[model samples]
Target: MEDLAQMTLDLTDRRLLSELQRKGRIFNSDLAEKVNLSASACHRRVQRLEAEGYINEYVALLDARKMGVPATIFVEITLSTQADEVLEAFEKAVQRIPDVLECHLTAGAADYILKVVAEDTEDFARIHRQYLTRLPGVAKMQSSFALRTVFKTTALPV
Candidate 1:
């Protein structure tokens, strides 16, 4: 295996990645034809791409509304201190919260930001009382409910 930093994506590889991003379950024969490569070559390239960490795990994108958890809440959390133990404890505890979709260590006013989902505003309040308030070292916390999602995507440009 070669160093990932040194590996460059050519046109064919880029095409393969782009195609895979849009249609992950695309058949190898169909993918090869789209990318203008032989089936064996395409298979090898896909394997190499995965091995090199160009491709991460594939997953099904679910509908939040259908799942009954459509409400989106963005939480800005300010810790009491920037101590390593406080940060570590908060990060570890936040990961255990199933309602929290994403937790990011951030810059600006807040030490951390959390993207959370719930059935509704009441549900969020329940989550806040049940989970958020109990998080270690939380000095100040602010939450904003999303009225609507103007744009959202999992795909990144290849």
Candidate 2:
């Protein structure tokens, strides 16, 4: 396997990635045509990209409202301590909560920021009571609910 750090993308590879980012389910032949490569060659490049960890797993982006989870909350968490063990314990505990879609450690007033989803405000209350409050070393937690999502995308610019 090629080292990811040493892997440089050429023009053709960039084209291939751009097409794939737009439509992950596009046919190999179609992708090849778009990138001006043979089907086999395109497939090989895709495989190599995956093997080199350039492309992670592909997933279907679901509609939260349709999936019965419409509420989106961003929670800022301040830990009681910045100790390694406290951070580790908090991260491990937060991972067990299914409602938490993303958690990021930040350098600001808050130690961590969490993106969470729920069916509604009532459900969010339950999640807060059941999970958020139970996280270890939590000194403070402030939550902001998103009224609407202006724009969201999973595709990364190549």
The number of clashing residue pairs in each candidate reads 0, 0
Worst 10 residues of 1 by lDDT: 1-10
* Model 2: per-residue Cα lDDT over 83-135, one tens digit each: 99999999999999999999999999999999999999999999999999999
- Per-residue lDDT tens digits for candidate 1, residues 39-141, read 9999999999998889988989899999999999999999999999999999999999999999999999999999999999999999999999999999999
Pairs of residues clashing in candidate 1: none
Global lDDT for candidate 1? Answer: 0.96
TM-score versus the correct structure, for each prediction: 0.95, 0.95
Instruction: For model 2, give the 10-residue run with minimal summed lDDT.
Output: 1-10
Segments of candidate 1 deviating more than 4 angstroms = 1-6
The CA-based lDDT of model 2 is what? 0.93
Name the TM-score of candidate 1: 0.95
- Give the CA lDDT, 0 to 100, for residue 145 in model 1: 97
Instruction: For residue 155, give model 2's deviation from the true position in Å.
Output: 1.3
